[model samples]
Target: MQASQLSRVLVVGASAAGLTTVESLRRKGHTGPITVLGEEPHAPYDRPPLSKQVLSGAWEPERAALRTREALSGLDAEFVFGDPAVALDTAARTVRTRSGRDLAADVVVIATGVRARQLPGQDDQEGVHTLRTLDDALALRAGLLAAERLVVVGEGVLGSEIAATARTLGLDVTLAGPLAAPMALQVGPLVSGLLADLHTERGVRLRLGTGVAGLDSRDGRVTGVRLATGEALPADVVAVSIGAVPATQWLEGSGLTLDNGVVCDSRCRAADGIYAVGDVARWYHEGLGRLIRLENRTNATEQAAAVADAVLGDDRPYTPVPYFWTDQYDARLQVHGFLPADAEVDVVEGDPTARRFVARYRSEGRVTGVLGWNMPKQTRLRRQEIADAVAAAPAH
Candidate 1:
């Protein structure tokens, strides 16, 4: 594919992946008419900071932005703000906006991302919120400052981080989730036990294996959550962080493969002249031997580069090890590679009792993943080392 031939590119969603896609195309010397359609009025911002630093009041909302207005404007890319793509016409290769505007493109990149899943009957309540976008984080932070009791509905990274922040702000927080352990999804049962201990030590109430029945509202202001067992936990604010559902509802008739997210091949190609990347893309990982959708900036940045190369017909399969990091209170947890349920977990260094350490997960005598607490540099190096080792080994 010649650079001149790859013209008229239209990228939907101005999040990390979409911004990187446009910049990548230009960096590859493709001087096509690039247009970035963003649903948010602001330019691309760092999402991880929203739940961590911004909500903690250590960083402002403007500081969380990844791209400045000048930087985005200087890229020579058309910036369409305050308009979200409403529908997709795959047959015509056009996208319809919520304002009823139609945009044509030679190639379409779906980086619409995912929205934080909300509990039923929670959206309309005043004190009920889900943090995903900058607005959500700002509102949540404000509410947390005034609330005495904070109820978090999920035990994932976002939920844990928010609970940590709420606690730091002198608010009583309760983490309500179905998992028996806090970090069960990433670090297995043993590590989850360690994480739960940390939360309990911080005076956080852990309500494990509990399901929220609905939101208790007083004249549209959320006051508490009704548990499945008919018990009502008194709270000033309820945050629904159940998980995230891919924002692919607009692609229902788009004729692209979507299973939980936009299903793409290893090359990130959903169809001819169309590709999907980032958290919204579900692609097969050769190392893991399964289709997985990751919600990390590392995946978004790395996959964006791969998608760029694939669009240029390089045929480079994206096989980078999935990596992620989370900041909870004083501890920084970093994860590298994949953690399969069947893998054997081993403690590499440090003890969970001290609340800082590294752990390795292996499958069939091969190290498949690494979990590090307060070990950023080690996590970075180990991810590359694991990817190389996995590449050299025979197919399992």
Candidate 2:
């Protein structure tokens, strides 16, 4: 079926990606019928703030709403909130919700995103939290407010950010992770070492280079984290940020290729009339010559636009420079393109001592990534270097 002839489009996730798909469709002149199915009752809201602003109490919950009520109503789409998609009939292009309603459409977009991963037996304990949804962040914030000591498991972006927020809230925060330093696997050794210093100076205890073995609890309340080496770090509260797995379990028998996420082509199309976007989509990258799924906020909206264009018969491949940012204390780090762990990094501008600089990452003498530490403009300008390099590289 052609784009103009499409009768209905069903989006199965009311996240930034899903909502953006709806908006992009309207903006691109796809005025046909559109339906949005959301598992959460709340309207689409921005998630990046849930960790830093919302959890820190710097921003009210309402401030995170992606669109005003009137704005959402203006989109002219049917929104089915609080009903989770339980299954998909790929052949019929129909989605079955948990409430036993089957909705069929000309095109179906999966933007269900992902669920936070927890350590074994962590969920049964009280005072243990995972921050993925708004509800999770609020609950964690409440726990942090009443707690004195917090042990954060995982040294990735989410865990590190939560540690910074909790420390700012006057909690004695201990960051535990298997990596050598905070964001070690992400920004490489040099930048992560600097982050280690920053967190240490900010009074966040670092318990790195050890994996969390399990949770220590008594009377159904979490007490601490047990390290792989058998050392126990006591805490009044614990937050798990190990990572997240794509929410694709419901697609188990749906006949779509599911490997870590909903596998899709370079166009983000999973089947003839179905597409996948956001964190739940592992789409092929023509430039990288492999499948990639980014969980960052930027990819959600960017991929949504790409999928929306595809739904409207745009044939261009979705090739984008991956970008993400993290705010810890006074430091705001913005990264563009790919920063492989083994990539050679050089400070191209500003001074690292002053904690304001733009660094370039090179792999095999090719500019693969650029990082900005409080140098947003310069870093953004440096993004073109990576883009130019990618354009010049031999197609894989």
Stretches off by above 4 angstroms in model 2 are none
Q: How accurate is candidate 2 locally (lDDT)?
A: 0.95
Q: Which stretches of candidate 1 lie over 4 Å from their true place?
A: 392-396
Q: Write the per-residue lDDT of candidate 2 for residues 283-362, one digit (tens) a residue.
A: 99888788999989999999999999999988989989999999999999999999998899999999999999999999
- Candidate 2 lowest-lDDT run of ten: 387-396
Q: How close is candidate 1 to the true structure, as a TM-score?
A: 0.96
Cα error, candidate 1, residue 108 (Å): 0.8
Please list the Cα RMSD from the true structure of every candidate, rounded to 1 decimal place.
Answer: 1.6, 0.7
Cα miss at 85, model 1 (Å)?
A: 0.7
lDDT to native, each model: 0.85, 0.95
